[model samples]
Target: MTMKKKKTIFTAVVLAVLLAACVAVDLTLPSYHIAVTVIKKATVYALVAVSMNLLNGFTGLFSLGQAGFMLLGAYAYGVLTIPVAKRASVYQYFDGGAIQFSLPEIFAGFLGDTVGSTVGMLLALLVGGLLAALMAYLIGLPVLRLKSDYLAIATLGFAEILRAFFQWNALGPITNGSNLLKSYPTFAHATPYVILAGLMIAVILLLITSTYGRAFRAIRDDEVAAEAMGINLARHKRMAFIISSFFAGIGGGMMAMYMGTIAAAPFKSTLTYEILLIVVIGGIGSITGSVLASFLYIFSSEWLLRGLDSGKFLGINSPIFKNGFRMVVLSVIIMCIVLFFRKGIMGDKELPDLLDRRSRKRKKEAAGK
Candidate 1:
């Protein structure tokens, strides 16, 4: 078979195995299993990390406002999806909030509950993405001009400000005023989460391979050179920011669903930093690296390391291994990964690229022999 056909087969096999695994996970494992939690969280993080990578890695925009955009997405989804019947209890302080209708309810009236809820939830997620994109466009107007650390700081500050704004009592009618947004409908299994996140990540892959993606890379390489080459710097930069924020927002909506509750308290700078760390660990400019690294990071931190915190780690129950100690070990492991793989696990090249390169290398060796 030709190289392209072989690559196609390989990709299909990998995807089929993954789909089977996800289905098996939900069908076989308990809903509360660590594996389920890890799958949900990892997929969410994978999408957010890739969104951040689109800006920081592909576009060379140093922005630190991911958590803020995510907050908007989370709130947007939560505020819109809370059941009409449960609104009174959920919004106890805000007179059931401004919106009276839920998307799922409207759609469910026509379709069956299962399909309607899924469709409505998807529309809400889309709304979240659009809202984040709008915010990004507004913010990018002023801060996108700032270079490097200044841009990062500006974006970070804005994110903090947005988070605070969401918590303001005056907006409580809609935002719930520092309270948790709960009772929002969510997928009961990890399969949907995996599929949704995977689809979005696939879109990112397509974008990265598109002409605009090439423009993003050009700008990342050198703005002056790219501009000289006739790439519209301002337009492309704004597009990149908006597009990145759109996906981040979707990720945030997914995050809200995964957690079953969300408050402004958790969408902090630290959250952005964690996603950034994942991106770095995966490789700055590698999508496959980001996705793979996200799963690894979430799995190890949330599952494999849980025993360390609960005094049951490694068959060595000790007083030293207490609450939060797992984080310490995880941190050390991350440091080691960073130190050893400075270019990250995949670097800029993708898995397919690596596979092709290896194939050619082996063929050359065979020819020499």
Candidate 2:
């Protein structure tokens, strides 16, 4: 067999093994285990970061409206999947609630309880993504006309406006008006998350390798030239925006399931900033880098540097170790990376690309010898 084919089989086997191990851990270990929680959060963030990269990295659109799309998705999923019996209790403050139905229950009637609920949850997540894409299409019509910082500012303002709108008292009946949305269906294990994220990312990779992907990269490199080359710049840009928002929405749905609650408060501009930072740290144009950085970011922030929040580490207590110290250290590390490794950890390259390069280098050395 060819070396490339062998390598492909090896990579597939390794991934399968890792996935099996993860499922085993999820089944055997407690749900509250820190590692388990981190993996879940990382998986969600990885999806969102990759979605953001699809627009910002490939299409060269500097959008900051991810939080808005995410909020829409979270609320959509939460509102639809919440048990019908719990609606009155959840929306007690909003005149006994506006929505009196449960999507999963509707599906349960036809598909049986367990399977129906799962199918309904999947459908609800899809609805969330569709809603987000619709919003993106509406917003992108005018916003895409702007360039660079102007586009970013407009999108950021839109997110803030949407947040405020969701919190408005007039929208209370539907949105719960600043109150938390809970009692929604959620995944009990990590296997589904792994599968869903893997599938979505695989779709994204396929998109990136297609003809449209080349057009996106072309526009990213030189918009005017791409336009001159007969590419419909506006159409391609809008497509990218809508597609990115769709995935962002799905990621948000996953996050809502992971958290078991949804609130407009958490879906702020800061959330967008965090996702953008992840993309930058991961290598803006590299999906593998985003996935890798997601785990690293989650681990370091949520686990490794957790001790910095307290005054103890490695059995040593120090005055310097205090609240906010972790963020300070993380900020410094980000700054160092920006200054020294501007292209980020992967630098617009995938793991396979790196492996191929190394293999070629070794072959060249062998020939020289």
Candidate 3:
């Protein structure tokens, strides 16, 4: 085999080993169920972080409303996936009685037991993503015209508008308004979510590594200069926005499936801010950093913050921290990270670079020997 091929094989083996080790370590956490749940949630957030980074990080767009897009995706996926039989019992908010659709026999065979439900769920998610991209394209026409704070407000307004629109009874047939959609699929195994997460990560990684992705970076660095250099700024900007929104929508659908319940209010500006927090803490344009940060942020909130807030520290009982303390602490941590470690943990660098460096060092050491 060629030297390059050998090195590639070795790298893949090493990465697989590392991944297994990490999973093993995660399994050893104090609460296995909680650990699994946190991981599942993190996977969804990781997708969001990557999507947001694609625009905010590489493309230099300060667009918000990520949460809104996610909500849209979640609802889209939820409405389509609930089993026909259980629709009446589960979806008390709406009456989607007597639905019918047929899947190909091979796909049905491959999906096995959950074929019908899973396929519906997948279709919903796909549709949600497409819808989000459509919304982004439409929204971008007007919102992208603004820059900086104006753009932020416009995007924020768009999210609010979406929330309000979803909450309105006129669209209740589709959204169920404020009523929670029940009888939805849960992350019982979390395998589907994990798979979706993997696909999203792969797509983002592939796109960001492509020449088009570099163009996105150029537009982000200097829109006017990129345009002057013969790059289609508007086209690229719109593409980034649409693509980011697409994934954000998918992430939202994943969240809905994982949570099994969602409310429109919770998916507003507050969520947008939280995602931004994760993105910033993870590093603006770094996908690896975003993945790590998503895990850190979600796990910290679920495990660490919840424990602290519940006052369950070594059998102690006191509410000294009080409510909202978690947010306060999170805010402080974010401030510190931003102030002390401005380039984010990874900045523009990816995690694979570290592994590459280690591999080269080992090769150099062997040569010296």
Candidate 4:
């Protein structure tokens, strides 16, 4: 087979195996298992991290407003998906909320409970993405004009402002006024989360290979040169910002589904920092890197090392292994990884690229013989 054919087959096989494994685990384990939670959380992070990487790595836009967009999305999904009957309890502080009709209910009436609710959930996510994109457009008009650290600062400030605005009592009827948004429908299985995140990431991969992705890369490399070559610098930057925010918004919806509850307090600047850290560790410009790094990071922090937090880890039980110990160990490991691979684990290369390199090396060795 040709190298391209081989790569395609390999990727397909890997995906199939992963799907089967996930399904098996989901069927065999309890819903509250750490593995299930890790998978769900990792997929959510993978989508958001890739979205951030699109602007920061692929397009060289250093905006730090991911959490704000996510907050917008989470609220959008929560506000739109709460069942009509449950609104009274979920929104007791706000007189059953400003919007009473749930998207799921509207669709379920005609499409049946199963498929209709699924469709409704997807629609709500799309709405959240659109809302975030709109906000990005308005915010980008002024903030995008800033450069480097100024741009980062402006975006971070925007996130903080957005978080506070959501908590404001004046908007309680819509946002629940600092209360948790819960009782919304959520996926009981990890498969759906994996499928959704995979589809979204695949779309991003396709975008990266298209002409627009090239334009993004050019701008990242040198704005003056790209602009001189007929690329619309301002327009592309705005597009990148808007598109990234759109995906971030959708990712936020996924996050809400995973958490089963969401509050504005969790969508803080620290959340953005964590996503950014994932992008950096995954290799900013590589989609596969982001995805792999996300899973690895989540597994380490959420599952593999969780025992340290309870004062016991691996066969060793020490006083030092008490609350927050896992984070300390995780931090040291992250530092080691960073020091070892200055450019990140994948360093801008995809899985196929790595395979090709290995193949070429083997050929060279045979040729020398």
Deviating ranges (above 4 Å) for candidate 3: 1-32, 90-112, 314-319, 356-369
Judged by lDDT relative to the true structure, which candidate is superior, 1 or 3?
1
Q: How much lDDT does each candidate structure score?
A: 0.93, 0.91, 0.79, 0.93
Q: List the residue pairs that clash in candidate 4.
A: none
Compute the lDDT for candidate 1: 0.93
Error of 3 at 209 (Å): 1.3
Per-candidate TM equals 0.97, 0.97, 0.86, 0.98
lDDT of 3: 0.79
241-270 per-residue lDDT for model 2 (tens digits)? 999999999999999999998999999999
Runs with alpha carbons beyond 4 Å of true place in candidate 2? none
Q: Is candidate 2 or candidate 3 better by TM-score?
A: 2
**2 against 4, candidate with superior lDDT:** 4
Q: Write model 1 residue lDDT over 1-369, tens digit each, in one string.
A: 987888778877887898899999999999998889999999999999999999999999999999999999999999889999999999998888888999988899899998998899999999999999999999999999899999999999999999989999999989999898899999889999999998999999899999999999999999999999999999999999999999999999999999999899989999999999899999999998999999999999998898999998879989988999989997887788778877888889876676688898999999999
* Tens digit of per-residue lDDT, candidate 3, span 1-369: 765676667747764774665466455654247866887898899899899999889999898879879988988877766655666665455565333322222245566756754675677788889999999999999988788789888988998999899888767666676877666655565445666787888898899889889899999888888989889978888999999999999999898877878678679798888888888888888997898899899888888787567666546667776666666777899999888988887887776565566778999999999
Give the TM-score ranking, best first: 4, 1, 2, 3
**For candidate 4, which ten residues in a row score worst on lDDT?**
333-342
Clashing pairs for predicted structure model 3, backbone only: none
The candidate, 1 or 2, that scores higher on lDDT is 1
Which model is ahead, 1 or 2, in terms of TM-score?
1
